[model samples]
Target: MLDQKLFRHPETLSALSDSLARRGFALEVNRISALENHRAELQSKTEQLQAKRNETSQQIGIIKAQGGDIQPLLDEVAGLGDALKIDQAQLHDVQEQLQAIYLSIPNVLDDSVPDGDSEDDNVESHRWGELRHFEFTPKAHPDLDKIGLDFESAAKISGARFAVLKGGLARLHRAIAQFMLDVQTQYHGYTEVYVPYLVSGEAMRGTGQLPKFEADLFKIEGKVAGDQDFYLIPTSEVPVTNLARDSIFDEQDLPQKYVAQTPCFRSEAGSHGRDVRGLIRQHQFEKVELIQFTKPEDSFDALESMREHAEAILQKLKLPYRVVTLCSGDIGFSASKTYDLEVWLPGQGQYREISSVSNTLDFQARRMKARYKNKQTGKTAFIHTLNGSGLAVGRTLVAIIENYQEADGSITVPEALRPYMNGMERIQL
Candidate 1:
């Protein structure tokens, strides 16, 4: 959202000079430059009381058209309409506190990122294939705890990080979310939506997931006692990037593209004990996201073509991935450049992040105003949003069950998901 006139301008500290240490973001851009100098001094005292109430409405229409005494110009136009209604209600409370601090600041990085603060300063950038060396000493997806992979019956029906999948591993986790929604909708053209896993806290503050990742999400409510309910999305990039929330497209729809698969939920609340085993970190999973809406000069080339459509589903399931690029504190909240991808697990030898690709340029389309139009100067701007993870369908089913496992343990069904598993190759019982 970052545009309260670029919080104290100077191009918002040179556009957050590459995510000022990733996502700490210059202490919230120095607290939105002190609320943009109190909304530019109450917008110059409300434009000097609307130019002294339009010159006191032309001196009360020339003092009642010069008829005898017009009560001394109506007592100076009733004291300039009570001081122009207190400088227009203090310039509408300093432009609603400078739109609650620049629509909740974010986005502004991309200077070849790579700084540092968290995620071990995240900056791997490349490395693809070469881990599977398990000569009979591998087994780690909770050691497939009894064939159907129950996970203590999903922690006794929904307790710790839930997971249930029965039979052929719930058809291999629903064929890895229908093979990542048919490869992100027929080979990366994206558009296959379904949305709404419950949203609206202004669509999770238009994608930055509200006032600081709301402790990694999961909310829901029937509203009341203290209001502000609704939540439970955590991804589908919060309802496919709020489907252009406030709307205004048409620069030939610049570059809409979308894709869903849904069920995300999260609330991993500070990741308590981190990756507490199996399906690594989860509070409900299933993904396939990949939103977009380009046009800030095509958002860093649509984040390198959505990170090559999540590395073309790990190069058509031959797996072995790597792509990284997220430094500047492991970029994310309304990213201004990111990459991720990761994959190549092989019993967790390393590389994980199953897809990311970002570029949130217009910072969530100026907080969901989501505009477009500028076809060679037609005007209407704000449109850079993006979202990714064209994978994450349960971490690509835990990176295809630890990279096509198989020490006679059976798993191999990858040739682009064996035609969505109907003609599956392996996953033996």
Candidate 2:
């Protein structure tokens, strides 16, 4: 949510309008201005009526003390009360209208974000490791041999965009998640967290997933009467970042880092035919998520560090990958800037996104009312929120399977995961 103060300054509002335009959002400047003006008028009227009512009540008290007739004063106060109610109602309605518009607005793009219309326009930052040259034609994860990547059974139970891994393959998936959690918690200085997979609508909204992207969520209606709907988390980011919602931290607690592994559920409403074959896109997927809340000025730097933390997992696994700076139009709704880590997949013979690190720059914090007190100024202000996929467990499994497949179809487990896999170096049928 943008600061309401931004609307008060014509220059800042215009600049914000321009920035939103670059993200392909058309700000209704005229409508916003009109609504704001009407809100101001109504609020002023409400305040004046309130003040007048107080003054009239005082006058009535004085008149009674003097033994004078108070009926006329009583009548005048009743009329004033009626008028005040009307103005107050109008003010409330206008404020709600303004809030809806504000909630719908995307965050302003960072100055450094490049202008572009699509992912094709995103700029590559750098690459790591070398793409492997296959002795034979590399096969996609779904087509690879016997190490259990079951889809038929999953379909019988749960329909499309779902899979069930068994045997060594399932263990490998668990191993990958464990390795990521250990790396994020032990080396990267992030506190490990266990978050509920189901969260409230407000929690979803706090992380910028509700109202606009509600279509992409799995909403569970309460079984009992009058129960609020619960949504299966789209990412651990939703619940983990929301830990700071409606909270105020002291300056020494300026940065809070948390990591969690969760099974994310998404409706995938807009993606109909894309990546329908494998785990690349799933209705349910496991992800290791990283979240941070930081002082506003330090968020961008924290974003870079978070990106590096994600990259460390790929490097340790010896996976080839590249980082790309997302263009304005390609960025997420709540992110001021984003960097995507695209890991090399031999099966697809191309790079595919495995993680995205973003700095929301108080975008989520404003919605969540997450703030910190400034020690020097002794004032409270919204903190900056950042989230990233330390790595998607399923995608990393896909990468390892394709990249480590032997000529005979056995997979040589990445050394980094060997400890978690109980020193079992290879997974074979």
Candidate 3:
């Protein structure tokens, strides 16, 4: 959401052009220039017409006051009014066209971001702990036989991409969410929040979810219990990050930390074939989201701290994981830079992302108009926004099931969660 005026300015445009080009987004400079030219022309014509109409109206008033035939002045004023109307219409058209271009223009990526197209191109920053070498062949998660958990039954009850965890399994899932929330709020300096599961289109747009990824949301059909076009939230981050929308904050309160556990829902329309068997991907899952609002200078520090906060959960649980920096194209629409914490999943025989931490800079804050005032300059500026999954609750469960599995088919509950699980050390079925 860089200013359109800056894109038009020669010096600013050159720096922006170089930054975007390095990040692999060939800025549509020509199209933007054409739209800007049309807007400039239309605005000039509108201003001139408005000035002429005002002067002619004053002349008509004077003629009528003088008791003279006002037809000639009236006719001239009427022609000016018509021209003004035409100018107004053209102004409206050109403004709309310019706005369309502005809205579509993406934020320039950070130079630190690696140039790549997909998840595979992301850089592996660092990894912790070693994978346990099992003497027996590891079984896939769907083949888990000891636990009463059944994905097939879940599918039968609620179609594909659903999961059913009854008895101890349900308790364990809840325990994981509580554990993540506790660590984030109590240890990591995040204020806990409980947000609405449903949100408006504006909230989604503020987070860069609409227009491009409408297929991934569960939009409520028709009118709900109340009159509103609400979408089931895909993440708690949507509401939490939007807390500062259209508001200004004090500089002292610059970095705001928020943590929330909510049930997230996603249609995930495009991921039709992948992870079809278990909790690796699901329609509804619980998550503890971490969101931060900070000054531009403090954003990168916030990013690393958020990543470590996510890693702390796994480390406490004794789950092996690695941190990775997401490449340019693989990063989300609003993220200038991102880090993903991928926990080791023995069942999948590879690392899978359990949390994604991103420093969005001012991209989302600008879109949401969230800002803070500099006391010295008396100027309000967009705050940098960052959000990360402390851990995706359902995927954490999957990782635990896979990574902490025993050769005998029973699952060992991670030590950190044992206290939450009533001192239980294993799930023996």
TM-score (C-alpha) between model 3 and the true structure? 0.92
Better of 1 and 2 by lDDT: 2
| Displacement of the residue 316 alpha carbon in candidate 3, Å | 0.8
Candidate 2 TM-score to native: 0.98
Residue pairs with colliding backbones in model 2 are: none
Q: How close is candidate 1 to the true structure, as a TM-score?
A: 0.36
Question: Residue 165, candidate 2: how far off, in angstroms?
Answer: 0.4
What is the number of backbone collisions in each predicted candidate, taken in the order shown? 3, 0, 0
Location of the lowest summed lDDT over 10 successive residues in candidate 1 = 17-26
lDDT (10s digit) by residue, model 1, range 256-369: 898888778787887788888777678888878788887788778888888888787777777788786877666776787788877777676777788787877887777778
Q: Please name the candidate that would achieve the greatest lDDT relative to the true structure.
A: 2
lDDT for predicted candidate 2 compared with the true structure:
0.93
lDDT per residue (tens digit) for residues 1-429 in model 2: 888888866787798888789999998888888998899889888899999999999999999999999999999999999999999888999999999999999888889999999999999999999899888999999997587888999999999999999888899999999999999988989999999998998998898997999999999998433798899999999999999999999989878999999999999999999999989999999999999999999999999999999999999999999999999889999999999999999888899999999999988999999999999999999999999999999999999999999888889999999898899988887
TM-score for each model = 0.36, 0.98, 0.92
Each prediction's Cα RMSD? 18.0, 1.0, 2.3
Candidate 2 residue-wise lDDT at 382: 94
- Model 3 stretches astray by more than 4 angstroms: 10-18, 21-26, 55-78, 225-228
